[model samples]
Target: MEKLRIVFMGTPDFAVGILDTIYNSQFEIAAVITAPDKPAGRGQKVSVSAVKTYALEKNLPILQPTNLKNEEFLAELASYNANLQIVVAFRMLPEVVWKMPKLGTFNLHASLLPNYRGAAPINWAIINGETETGVTTFFIDDKIDTGAMILNKKIAIDSNENVGQLHDKLMHLGSETVIETLELIEKGNVTTTIQTENSELKTAYKLNKDNCKIDWTKSGIEIYNQIRGLCPYPAAWTYIKDGENEWNVKIYDSKYIEEAHTYSIGTIISGKKEMKIAVANGFIQIESLQFPGKNKMQIHELLNGTQISSEAFVK
Candidate 1:
């Protein structure tokens, strides 16, 4: 197979892994398209995207497009004369950009196609308490994640796996799968499989602050999964009322205890060194947590330094 001229499009740490793989391979990466720098963190300092940083380190040409459909951006992209385009963890592209390449454009999705085919697949799969999920490579189409799949690799979701753990697993798995798909395309031996038709499809829409709030009304296992799914970033939060002030507590590591508890649902049960909350069927022990204006710490540490009110309840 000839050394193919490729253009890579991505913006997050997840996409950086695949770009690294391509950079170290025989394929020629003509240009990289990533999101423009945005203000972030305390003091709102300008921050470059992961892909842009990697591209700069490798001395590869870079394009930070505010809009993919802009004529100037499209004209510059077409100048790369790339045979194919690879997208991972990037914004949706218009057809004018996706169809610019000779081999068309393909995306590396974090979850298996036809399922979890939306924005936040890695988090949603864990949030819904799924036992298995996988990554897929597919040709881009008009609808999001609705294209025919070229390759897929399944991975088991451990019972105690959280979004952070699962995200790492899929990232490495996707890297390998993407390389394999690119090789198949180069050899003109790739086979495409259509996504299964279904009336009921699982959607992984973008998570918002309201969706991250823990709902104790759900079953013990459901609440447990929710806590784990949102841990580490955009963490699962709940308001705790302490007399006059309401404090926001972000819950991280947790486990559901099957043993019955006398406390009412939503009640905050605490020990001298640990904290637990009652759910519908059981109790969830909080392993790590953070209160408003506080750093993340283990329950034992928080219990030692802070006094929690006895009447406080998760709102």
Candidate 2:
């Protein structure tokens, strides 16, 4: 129960909240391990990870290793002499690193373990039309997302909740869980539960460009879920062809019309302030979308400037 020295590993904004919460806690943070700076944006300027920025501001030691198994990096990481290591939104760690900490490394995952176990869990849960999702903290093991569970906290997924909304919710929920986990570890009261392997478990594989493309042949509800699941990041995109003009349009927000429609799927029905695409069940009413080289905007705003005819078909 003595003051525990901890090391944190993460890279994205999702990890930032948890790191900030832990940094403000009573435990001593030995060092932070994050991804190396990479070039980004139009100028291709080097950009630091969110964790690194926050760690620098808090004056915490940082180590960004290009190779996790490198001897020099491993030696430096071992020098921290941390009792526990916490990971959130980070790459898979080698056994040498996760096994080094006395209390072992625990990862903050976006979904409840034993289900939706993979990258992009939040997106897959919604895409599969699940009404519930949760966050879990588990000990790091050799297999991805396959580890003994420490604790989990469930949260309801609204019928129409998008991935972006669910992501922020889980991020904050995970912060609280991480703090509770640290307390459990310090008190020596942690009991790990083996993750039950189910053959029917739905693995959340990382989304790709091809997978995010809207499939108009599906029902309106299915299309609606797909749009929301991929919203605000790697959005659901489709080709819009207007005679000689064919361009890609990414859908960010939409609604489903359950009423039956006779029109063939992918038919674009446009109006002054509203646009809908025909599907097997009915239509997917476009609410917010982005054109190539343009910022996301409402259907009306897009219609006001673009000459998208009702006759134009969506592919």
Highest-lDDT candidate: 2
Candidate 1 segments exceeding 4 Å error = none
Candidate 1, residue 3: the lDDT equals: 57
lDDT of each: 0.90, 0.92
Model 2 lDDT tens row, 230-264: 98887999999998899898999999988776887
Estimated TM-score per prediction?
A: 0.98, 0.98
Model 2 clash pairs are none
For model 2, the superposed segments whose C-alpha errors exceed 4 Å read: none
